[model samples]
Target: LTCERYPVRRLPFSVVSEEDLASFERIVPGRVVTDPEELEASNVDWLRTMRGCSKVLLKPRTTEEVSCILRYCHGRNLAVNPQGGNTGLVGGSVPVFDEVILSTALMNQVISFHSVSGTLVCQAGCVLEELSRYVEERGFVVPLDLGAKGSCHIGGNLATNAGGLRLLRYGSLRGTVLGLEAVLADGTVLNCLTSLRKDNTGYDLKQLFIGSEGTLGVITAVSILCPPKPGAVNVAFLGCPGFAEVLQTFSACKGMLGEILSAFEFMDAECMRLVQHHLLLACPVQESPFYVLVETSGSRAEHDAEKLGGFLDQALGSGLVTDGTLATDQRKVKMLWALRERITEALSRDGHVYKYDVSLPLDRLYDLVTDLRARLRPPAKHVVGYGHLGDGNLHLNVTAEAFSAPLLGDLEPYVYEWTAGQRGSVSAEHGVGFRKRGALGYSKPPEALQLMQQLKTLLDPKGILNPYKTLPVQA
Candidate 1:
């Protein structure tokens, strides 16, 4: 049924026979899940747009167990889907067909942490929020923060190279992650998990798997550099009269706040309405065309507060911000953040959401959403835009009563072409999973795609690891 909605011919790979299940049981005894009821959740993605019929789910606790399982699967010529958290917006986390689901759920462990250096080495399956708590207790904070931090695994985050709220201050996972250990297609363990920040010995092999989306290998362990937890943190929720004013406010924010600025996120009025209507969230500021959430983190509370207050005064004085509310306490900070972070959940509740994550020039970030709202008049229930403005990532979401092929037809090539025209990324934070594999050409050239295919082939000769993901199928 899923295949009917998103058609793909199943590749020739061995199906799971009784002997195969028996071998998997020996590899990860008592962890091989085959029951359909239990597999239901694992087979579906977080967005619920993609579904798979994977018969076997393998949960391994250690890299050795994962290596052994991949080794066995490689020999059997069976397709293996390496999954983590299963919170991927793309269909990459879920098996497209009957591929054996190799999950890192049971590999949750903190391998090591250096308090002085603030380097954290942890198992791939450790939840992001728990890791954040663990690091915060030691006076450090994880470089990234996502809406699904409570459930999304560190491995999954690395696999997708997730750029979240704190990316503005901390940079991407590719920069924060010092090293990692991954299990290759043939079960060879590539152990580059070093805590050292500067290592230019040779080819940075770990970078290959950071955003490869599991098509290259399964990331087992990671060593990341966490920044020291800020002594003072503040959140400002402001309403902007228009998109231009929002841009002006961000410019002023960066200028005034300087290094203390941690994040700059924006959402249209439509997104705020959806959040209020569906999630029962209250608007902290007066209603306006656009809203911006600015965050500050610094070592000195008084100095940080002064800088933030100055930035706010400048924004309000310049007519960049219509109305605003600043929060110094943790409760208010969290409340302000919830309005931006929960936009995805609110949009989902409204109707079937067609989500697109793109990176455009800052000035043209919100243009696509406005264009779509005008284009899809009758079918589209709502077209909203929201995302990290500092990083130039736009989350354009369109909702309809339900999924319709005609509606999708109106969005596709048009959206991709518009992104390509601006020389922007079609998939900014989210990797090119099964759903966006075909659109890879929009972002990458043919030669790049060819080289990507070559890398996939060299790393996974049999194409047994996460087939139908990341790279586009060559015609």
Candidate 2:
């Protein structure tokens, strides 16, 4: 939440004048909120790691209103921060300074849903969990499911290119989002809201704004392809003696379960201990160095159970797994899945948490956590490792008495250097917000970085959109 230490200098942009406030009022009069109390929440991030001092917040209910606000802001050189759910981990959602907040809270509405093709088009501010429930009633499933589903807006998920629990099977938003409608910097509405699965007419322009993190434009609507809800689902929690056994178990599950494998997640004993101590959630299986949670969904319950049972038997028989528990009922399935999803909630109660969601080579995934635990045992409260093992994404977190400078100094260039040595990405699911913006060079080449800068310039010429985030500071 400290902004004084952050290195980025504020751009020389026009402040929101009385005239500017009046113009925003013209768009949505009652929704223009400038009260200090209400503005405090949107000014800070979900993790409470960053804060902004924006004086005005505008809530636009329709795409045309959003376009009008952006176009006017563009002409006046007034910086705007487009916000959806504001549940982002990195400092991407909150503003760094006094930029006018352009919120999509009032824009929540389901536009059209074709049950036959399983395509749903809705306003960008729709809450992800609400959409899931709405589609579930119609026998369709939203492709992306995350821990923040209850609060995270679908547009915010698309903005950050969120890769949640379902990515192992449903894939990324870049593939699931078929078309979108965005308001450019000049208020130009680029509507590519196509429902067709195959549209090769011209260049796919909507993909640019999908993961751009509100830098290029304000996404007002999204057209995503929703998959049908699977008839049968099962979850299994297993204990492994070591990381090697976890790997072997993963291989066996993939080879045997094949198509129905929904998610494959792993966590170390440290994570479980913290969850039990802080959150009072007991582990299903006995204590082990490692644990795995496997989920399978199919059309037939009996067939899925037989396949999962066979995989469990092979894993137990081959010594890949030491102990396990299975759940087929909905309530039990949710109870088991909560152990993996609630790691974030549990960490919040401990103390200030330093999180690094990185994508590393499978072999070197846990090495960073091990090295940190050995190096800084006294100063560091706990070094926990747990994440989506199926996609080689490691959620490495270090809890401490407070945010210590020495701990960060030892971890930073050290972790980035280690991941870079293995040709890994510094960020996996969490985008490079202000927290990790400087580390982009480690994962990107000079040529690629230049091209990204070029795109930013071409789209948002004035850089009035969410600044001091996404791309690294200009050299």
Candidate 3:
């Protein structure tokens, strides 16, 4: 099968023969899947944007099985695509050609959890939400959280170095993920799974695989440092009359409640319209040009509530906020958070999505969306912007009834060039999967790109791991 939107010729990798299938069956037994019906879902990505046509899928249960599968595949010079939850927004987790699909679905197991240090050691396939519940019961919380937590695997999160709502408080996975175990292309297991908080060991080998998008190695297990569950949590959804007010309110928030602030997210009025129209979710606050979601987590309920109230009062009195609604109850908090978290789902229901995740200087974060809206309104259904305002990331999305080549042409180099002009990142939290591979140069210099290629060559000399993804084509 050929990818029409992103055309690519098949690479010169060895095709899977009967002997390969038999060997895979011997390794995974009943877990080798070749039926067309069974392989359909794993062939596509979460955004439904990319599809692959792999003939085999292997479900490995343990690290040993993963090593054996890779070792055999490497010996035969077969391309292997490592898959986790398949919840990636980019086309990273799926195969672009007839590569062997190595899935971690059966590797879901929590090995250990230290109650005092709040370190969680688990197999790669453990679902993020499941791990969250497991740690919450033990008075701790997973350091990261996103809309796809219900289905996203911790392995995929590490593969992308995912940063979600709690990132403002807990920071990125690169810091929280203290150690990990990964299997290289030659089936050598790099066991670095340690739970230590401090280790000045010569080289942090785990960092190489954290955001490599499964190109360097297949992550088998992870040891992450979880933070203690806060005693109190509060969410406030506020409406701003303009983007200036939204920025002012954020400044006020940091000045007043920075210590306990957990998240600061903002969305345009268009995003609110889509969520309300498609998801049937009611907005918690009054109608306004912009909206912001503020969350606070702290040790004492009364103290956190008082601080949030003071921040809100100052924001409203200073004309930084026009209307707002606060939630302390669990049910209400979820409802409020849904308005921001479910924007991706709502956009999907609208039509084809041209999704772009970038990091810009806070002052110019929303300008790209405004420029695009003016440039492509007739052909574009909606051009909206929203993301983790605390971290200066923008999720600029455009929708239409269907994908159009001309529309994509209008978005490409323009968006990348604008982001580059502002000295911003083109991929942001989303790793450089197939879709963004060619755009890597817009974010990194020639020297950096050359070093990345050297590293990819060093790790997988045969280029058998997740080929046609991440790195850009060389000149």
lDDT per residue as tens, model 3, 65-84: 99999999889999999998
Candidate 1: where is the Cα deviation over 4 Å?
none
Which has the better TM-score: candidate 2, or candidate 3? 3
Give RMSD to native, each candidate: 1.0, 1.3, 0.9
lDDT, candidates in the order shown: 0.93, 0.90, 0.93
Can you give the TM-score per candidate against the true fold? 0.99, 0.98, 0.99
Candidate 3, which segments miss by more than 4 Å at Cα?
none
For the record, the alpha-carbon RMSD of candidate 2 to the native fold, in angstroms, is 1.3
In candidate 1, list every pair of residues with a backbone clash.
none
Name the 10 consecutive residues with the lowest summed lDDT in model 1: 1-10
Model 2 clashing residue pairs (backbone): 1-49
User: Which regions of candidate 2 fall more than 4 Å away from where they truly are?
Assistant: none
lDDT of 3: 0.93
lDDT of 2 by residue, 11-73 (tens): 888999999888889988788999999999999998887889999999999999999999999
